[model samples]
Target: MTEIRHYKIGEDRFKISEDEVARRELKVTKVADDVIQIQEEIHGIIALVGATSTVNIKKDELKELIKIVREEFGWTDIC
Candidate 1:
């Protein structure tokens, strides 16, 4: 079974998972914008890891990998 996780970005809350479920609705706030920035930072870290690795992964794959890592590390409150 695929696990589902929800996140709130700038006025744009969404859920991600290995499954194909639609995201839940969320409210937008200044904090949400900040969350988006942190998410970008997470993506940056993933990009860096990809750059340093021998594997030639695409940006989308890197993003998915990052999400998995974050979930494993219990980094739900990254921002």
Candidate 2:
């Protein structure tokens, strides 16, 4: 089994695991600013695929997903 951890960057929080950290071709370093940087491998692949097949999720939807994950893990707000 793999263990995942969630951390709040400023006010928002997200779940990420050790495996994900290692495998992520794109990094969401500063979520608050919505600034994401993709690695060369990911960039090359994305360039070929293009950004046409994308789903735009609302902020509320993302918040709900985060809430569900947090609740499932019995996480508490320490901050």
Best by TM-score: 1
Per-candidate alpha-carbon RMSD to the true structure: 15.4, 13.4
Candidate number achieving the greatest lDDT relative to the actual structure: 1
How many clashing residue pairs, candidate 2? 0
lDDT of 2 by residue, 1-79 (tens): 4444333312222335443322112211222222222222222122255555443345654564456434544435512
Clash pairs for candidate 1 = none
Model 1 Cα lDDT, one tens digit per residue, 1-79: 4443444332222334454333222211223322322232122112243344232334554565456445643456553
Q: What is the number of backbone collisions in each predicted candidate, taken in the order shown?
A: 0, 0
Question: Which residue pairs clash in candidate 2?
Answer: none
| TM-score for all models, in order of appearance | 0.26, 0.25
Worst 10 residues of 2 by lDDT: 21-30
Q: What's the lDDT of the predicted structure labeled candidate 2?
A: 0.34
